[model samples]
Target: MDDIVRQALAKWPDVPSCTGWLLLDRRGNWRMRDEAAQAGGAAGTPIRHTALLAFINRNYEADESGQWFFQNGPQRVYVELAYTPWVVRLSADAGGALSLTDQAGGVFEPSAVYVDDEGGVLFVDRSAPPRVAVLHDHDLEVFSDHAQLADDGVSGAFFWRDGVALPLQAVRRADVAGRFGFVVSPATRA
Candidate 1:
């Protein structure tokens, strides 16, 4: 959290939270939904401002109920998730080691990997309250190159550059939010 935001919260502690106004898309894009967009169930306009994006990323957090939000100074702007709370992109280090980086630019060290029924990949970090991140669609090819499927075609293992093969688990898309403890749409919860 930013010092300025903390000060604002201290000054005005009763600011009501805003929802159905901001969204985090599956491709890691931040979107701003207007009234019309929200009413029509549209994805809204993509937020391209670099500074604003950085600020939102810096203050992003999740509540105890697993509702993700951006602490915008005094008011909490809840984020409507298009998929998981995070969308992670796969990158290779100088040593050709695989690594994961979330849309917010935070390094995500995945402790487990899961493949959904639709073939979508998800990475779960080792945090106490583990976070689940969907693999960016663009990085699917790269991910496939490092993964080996088992004879059953459902199970697999991801081979990292260090020669450690992390076993992959199968997950159903519908069960993801419940299994991971996150709300896909916080606005609906309200």
Candidate 2:
């Protein structure tokens, strides 16, 4: 178990309601396999909290290649790599103007942000030129909702080839930091 994961588990013991958690190892393959273990009250059946905590304390081992796991219950999520700025920070001024900042130092004053039902952040830039975006890894980016506003609006649905942006009509549904969200760019791309 990583120090952050440990701290999260300790802080939020309720478990089910927690949305996000991270595990990092020297190796790239980190997986969390959550199984039912058993159904109903068996002879030594442990509840969700007890079983999860036990697994975290004991089975939280990393291999020589730096692979780690964070099994919750029935969700086996795998993380192949790691990066900084795992969480994004958004601030709004008294006038309702918003500014976004991530760990990568991306500061974007986007026109608006649409938070989807799945709890993802979609920043729409209608004022900026479509030819350039500040996000580094556009391929793994996702959109909060699939609603199309106008041609001038730039959706977070572009992929990268050789560090260049390629627009994709499909909306993204995963969390990819290096590319999608705003970070400080040395200069404007457009």
Please tell me which predicted candidate would have the highest lDDT against the true structure: 1
Q: What is the C-alpha RMSD of each candidate to the true structure, in Å?
A: 1.6, 15.8
Please give, for residues 18-127, the per-residue lDDT of candidate 2 as tens digits.
Answer: 21233321121222323321132112222346544455534333222333333443322232223312223444456534344432234544444433333344444443
Q: Between which residue pairs do clashes occur in model 1?
A: none
Which lDDT value does model 1 have at 115? 92
lDDT of 1 by residue, 118-171 (tens): 889999998888999999999998898889988765598998656888899999
Candidate lDDT scores, in order, read 0.91, 0.33
Name the Cα RMSD for model 1. 1.6
User: How high is each candidate's TM-score?
Assistant: 0.95, 0.23
* Candidate 1 minimal-lDDT segment of 10 residues: 181-190
